[model samples]
Target chain A: MAELTYIEAINSALREELARDRGVYVIGEDVALGGPFGATKGLAAEFGERRVVNTPISEGAIMGLATGAAAMGLRPVIEVMFVDFITLAMDQLVNHAAKLHYMSGGQLGIPLTVRVQQGAAGNGGAQHSQSLEAWFIHVPGLKVVMPSNPADAKGLLTAAIRDDSPVICIEHRALYWTRGEVPDGEHTIPIGRAALRRPGKDVTLVATSRMVEVALEVAGTLANEGIEVEVIDPRSLLPLDLDTITASLRKTGRLVIAHEAVEGAGFGAELLAQVQEAAFDYLDAPIARVGAPFAPVPASPVLEQAFVPGAERLAGAVRKVVLGA
Target chain B: MTSELNQQEAMELLRTMLLIRRFEEGLIQTQKSGISIGHFHVYIGQECTGAAAIALLEPQDKIATTHRNHGHLLARGADPRRLYAEILGKAAGYNKGKGGTLHATVAGLGFLSTSALVGGAVPLAVGAGFAAKQLGERCVSVGFFGDGVLEEGVFFESLNMASLWKLPVVFMCENNSAGALGQSAGEYPGSTIATKQLIDVVAPFGVPASAVDGGDPRAVRDVTQQALARARNGGGPTFIEARTVRWPGSRPLWPELSTGETDVAFAWEPDRIPMAHRDWFANDGLIRYVRQLFDAKLANTKEILALDATVRADLAKAMRFAIEAPYPDPASALDDVFA
Candidate 1:
């Protein structure tokens, strides 16, 4: 195993994909110039200009071109820089890439991966801080993945590169510096599965992205308070691991959904519906969700802290579900 | 230079044009009778243009078109019955009843699927052309669009990229003079001049371009032939502007809801120019040659109509099969969401 940061793991995954598949290529606005966040540093020099291409400031053209290239048997790992910029290419993603397979009656496959930084990190407020995973997860034909740690970030992205469908892989800018133990060689994490971070019996906590790490922390603190918490990290939001959640709900009988996105209309609503429908009878109490408030992420640090959900909010939700607080 | 096509080849072109005209006329009638449903855009006046452009292409060459695409599809040799059934929303349709008139596709037939969104298919052709060049297939990718799509920035970007890459793509602008009632070429003089100057601007980028009379199918065909030959020889992309007149709903079979009171009077007028052109040919005792050509075209179209009927019937059966095919299990809805 090698100690690597999230950004390093991503760079490593890109290198491996490029070396392994001749069809793979990368393109973005500043990708060749070491990327906007230096995630692709030295890639252009190592792989040459053709494989690591620098494109004009046309997100729509970049994505449309990538979709067309992927359909023509090229594995394009497109970096849109920020998830917010993905709005510019929504038509191509929504109309063409996502619907091509089902609309074409299975004649085409879009094996393209769009890499973007998602969720709030540091003081990048409002425009840059929003997490839009729920929007993509709503689309049917796309695979939405939000990796919380370095290991799964590399493994899941590699698998996404090789998959026969379009994958929207979101990484948080905050997690890029966080370190983890990733395998030395090639590895892959299946897209639809969830990972159990902390096993407990009192209450089940489901989280994604950076929220997964916070939920694990809260579970540890909750254990000392005589209340055990089970934490489940859904690596992929689109292909949700309902089997894992359903099994955990059967044991705990209490659930708490958490994410960095605002509380209302977030992925929390979808998870609540799924768990309530499948494991409704096993519930000892109604499920609770801890998330950002239903408002834009504020610019001030104090307001930003109040806006995002953290371990304190999650632990409070677990206490409510478990101790009837 | 113009004598490459013999009389036989010329006649074949006319026959294809007639086939599209008659098929569209029939569809207009059927659609009005409630036999076919949903949005149906006919390319009546644009027949000659499509026939001519497609005639230049070999069966292996690929083409992409916009939503107003029946003529283009028929010109590219799509089976009329499957297209008709598709318009009728039958399971045996091109997209198995899912994609209607706007989204009909037959990929294996070298008609790479069309995008209903304007200018969407143009960039796709660039990628296809790039792939064809990489594979050394000696094939050219053609993109067909109306005047409305020029307003999109991607159109220029596509031209620039395709030219820079020296990809074999034919970007044909069927400037039909109208983008749904607003005069197209007149509204945007600045862009029009730019578009008019595309051939010169693109030449230096390694891609050559030209414009033609879109109303004249013969002219379109000739231009396409040149473009394809240039492309196959690795001469890069070309942009052609086919300046054609839009015959506003010439097929009186499908009348607008606003034309309800005067529908019968409208039907009495002959919207097809060929029928009128035939009489003009006859008054000078040149009727013999015209009659012989018209008779052969009618015969060929009748044969295609017979096949169209069989395909429609087969598609009806397929529709029944799909409708009764059972809705997917609700539980399965939760599946395939992630991976």
Candidate 2:
């Protein structure tokens, strides 16, 4: 095992996938220049220009081109710079890529992976900072994955590249520099499995992407107070591991869903509905959702800090469920 | 810039065009009888463009076409019975009834997909060409779209990338508005593009562009050959605007069989043609191709009539088979979503 940053793990995964499969190729804007956030660092030079291609600032064309290539027996891993910009390519992603295999009656298999970043990191403004994982998880054909750390990042990306379906790998920019222990060789995590950050028995705290960090921090603080908290990081949102969350709910009897997206009509709502449906009698208290307010991410750093839900907001929600304060 | 199509190949081209024409004629009739449901488009007026151009493609080459995709599919030798059943949403269809008329695609026949959305196939062809280049294959990819494709921003984006990357692709834009007073006949039902000439839109990209009479099979065949040759040689993409006169049948909001099934004899005996749709027959590319065949002594009236008769009989069988085909199992609707 080695300690690598989240971005380094992602870059390592791309390098390994390219080296492993001759059919695998990378295409995106500035991807040859190692991408906007260095997720593709040192990949273009390592794989050469043919395998790592750079396209113009055309999201729709990029998505459509990747879809076509994937259907034609090439495993294309495309980068869209940011999740917010994916709105431009939604037709190709939602209408074409998400529907091609089904529409073609199993004649076409799109083994495509789209890598994009989100979160209110560096006060990047509303256009770049918003988390849009909620939009993709709703798509049927797509498998949505959000890695919380370095190990999951490398493992999940490798799985996505090898999968037969089109997968969307959404990374949080704030966690790129965070250091974590990642396995040395050939690490792969299943698409729908949930990872338990901390095993406990009082409250089941569920989080996604960067919000997993907040859940862990709040759970650690609560641990010192003799309050046992179970932290569950649902790595893959689309093929959700509801059984794990429900199993934890059977013990904890309380649940709190946390994410960087808006609290209203976000992935939290979907999770809340499913959790209640599966384990309605397991609840000792009403579920609490910790997320940003229903508004665009602000430009100012201070406003952005207030806009994004952090450890304190999650801690408050945890305290409400446990301490009843 | 030459096509060495032998007499046999020439007859095969005519047979494919006839099949496309008869299949569409049957579809129009079926729609009229309120049997075939939903909104569907046809390739009645621009048969020569699809048949001649696709005739030049090898079996290994890839194609990305748009909504009016029946002709392209048939030209690639798609079985009419399955294609007919696909249009009728039957289990024996090409796409297992999942994709009806608009999205019917033959994956094994190099047509892995045909987008229902306008201009969606251009970028797909770019990717297909990219894959071919990566594999070091000499096969060229073709994007068959309408003139309305030029209105989409992705069309420009796709062309720019194909030229910059030297990707082997042919952007075949069928402009069936030669007599529509410059008004496009599809999507918005008018030419709303700001560019005066559609070919001029891709001029700044430095790629070679051509404008040919979409009616002339040999002329369309020659231009398509030139573009395909350039692509196969790694010379990059070529945009060919094949212009044909829009048939009166496609003029209204809903397609009507205004010109009727097609009369091959009108090419030889123009005086006997009906006056109401005379302009349509005069501008019809299929009729012009037949006259070219007659003038060159490549085929006689008896031979052409025999070919049409065979196509009609086959189409009649295919249509009956499709009409009697079963609808897909409702439980299998969720299948193929992942694979």
- Give one digit per residue, the lDDT tens place, for model 1 in A115-199: 9997777767888899888888888889999999999989999999999899999998889999999998897999999999989
Q: Model 1's chain B TM-score?
A: 0.72
Give TM per candidate.
Answer: 0.85, 0.96
TM-score of 2: 0.96
Which runs of model 1 end up more than 4 angstroms from their true locations? B133-137, B181-208, B229-235, B250-339
lDDT string for model 1 (B74-140, tens) is: 8777777777766666656666655667777777767665788877887777767766776578888
Best candidate, lDDT: 2
Show the lowest summed lDDT stretch of 10 residues, model 2 chain B. B178-187
Residue clash pairs of candidate 2: B184-B191
Itemize residue pairs with steric clashes in candidate 1.
A238-B337, A238-B338, A239-B337, A239-B338, B48-B217, B214-B243
- Model 2 chain A: ten consecutive residues of lowest lDDT: A316-325
Off by over 4 Å in 2: A323-325, B1-4, B178-190, B251-253
Give the i-RMS of model 2 in Å.
0.8
lDDT digits (tens) for residues A203-243 of candidate 2 = 99999999888888888998888889899999999899999
Give the TM-score of candidate 2 (chain A): 0.98
